[model samples]
Target: MVDNRVNPTSNMKLLLYNQVDGRCPFCGKNLHYVKNQIQTLLEIAHIYPANPKSHEAELLKDVPRLSEDVNSMENLIVACRDCHKKFDHPRTAEDYYRWYDLKKELMLNDEAKSAFFDNNVEEDIIKVMDSLLKIECESDLVQLSLSALKLDEKINKENSFIFRKKIRDQVVDYYPMVREQFNELDAISPYQFEKIATQVKGCYLTLIKINENQEAVFRMLVAWLDEKTGKISSLACEIIISFFIQNCEVFS
Candidate 1:
């Protein structure tokens, strides 16, 4: 009998096929769900991708249950109802992900395992470096400065000041030395991925504060981003709109 615990939004199908092992997680249709018994039946669908505009940032910050909770593995699951229509955006997993335990347990992939471990370490190091950079630039007055740093290679020196200011003073002025240290640290330290989620939440909060009273600047900044990646968290947008609603006098 297939376990009836995991939620089966279309998004979970891809996750299950790629990430899970055995049985249809939503319906009791594991090998049976596989068409011709030759290929597995499944698909991956994002639960909240449809209604992303409706998501408020604060809700994402508080309710770990929300599909916006990018940190937890539980945010996604496997489902087989290609026809069982419900919410269109496919955010919530009503079934839960316990059905895939067998897959995680039985799959013995030495190379994949090594790569996964290495990636986790890389993520952890990136998170720490990000935190350190945040502290260093807290007074820089740019909301997405750290994320901007990731785009340094692509930044046009003439227009880059809209986000991060150019630095040419003190120890940081020795750009090569600073780059060397960061590269060395990235090479040596194992990433603490477990902490990344917490950092993301914190960064979201910072993003909110920075955007609150600076609509023009915020909008301009977002304009530079690619359409697919430029949108701020719906949660952040909600907070920004709410502030204006509550303090219309300040704008006047």
Candidate 2:
């Protein structure tokens, strides 16, 4: 898990946070509306609740784009006295959705849309979306079909065909539109399917590159290397450094 106390880069903080008075972001409601109190003033609302377990009770989730410090400028959203009071008591699941629907209807801004999606798809649901997209665009019909059959055989060789049908059923249910596109590919040549498969995979990776996770993994590896010694250890670090350079080469 990442340390949750450090503020993100200064440049990013300014981009997300209000510069003046930092009152309620939506309506610009004064921070000290009633008594002009400092402590009772606005508090930073963590867009995504950091603690998932406490999230159901609190109705907040950690926003990946925000800094590690949950209260940092990037994570903070100033809400007015009225809005803050309403969120104090947890709303029911139905009520929460209803409230979100009304809020979304009233404010069709970018922030509202982002907040709505962030709360609804609370988890790392984007990964599931990406996986479904990949399945839809997959070609190499012969190879794909063979691989599916092999997987089914491993699960239950006695009912391999039935298992295969289950996989196909899942794909159709996940992407009904893609199912039609996939059926059209059946008339194409097997070699063409293989070529298209390679292209589609490349396109999919480009669409949603998980560079942040890759960077975190690399950073952790470097930290591990620093704790070790020997010429080979130094050489290993050199290779990792080179890998990063090559990884960024595509941008050049």
Residue 73 lDDT (model 1): 38
Residue-level lDDT tens digits of model 1 in 47-155: 3232243443333333333333532234444445551233333333332122324223423442455544444543443443343344444353223223322323422
- What is the C-alpha lDDT profile of model 2 across 215-247, one tens digit per residue? 343344444333432223433342332222222
RMSD of 1: 19.8
Runs in model 1 lying further than 4 Å from the true structure:
1-16, 26-28, 31-40, 43-45, 52-62, 65-76, 82-187, 190-252
Q: Alpha carbon lDDT of residue 64, candidate 2?
A: 27
Per-model TM-score on C-alpha atoms: 0.24, 0.24
- Go through the candidates in order and give each one's C-alpha lDDT: 0.36, 0.39
| Best-performing candidate as measured by lDDT | 2
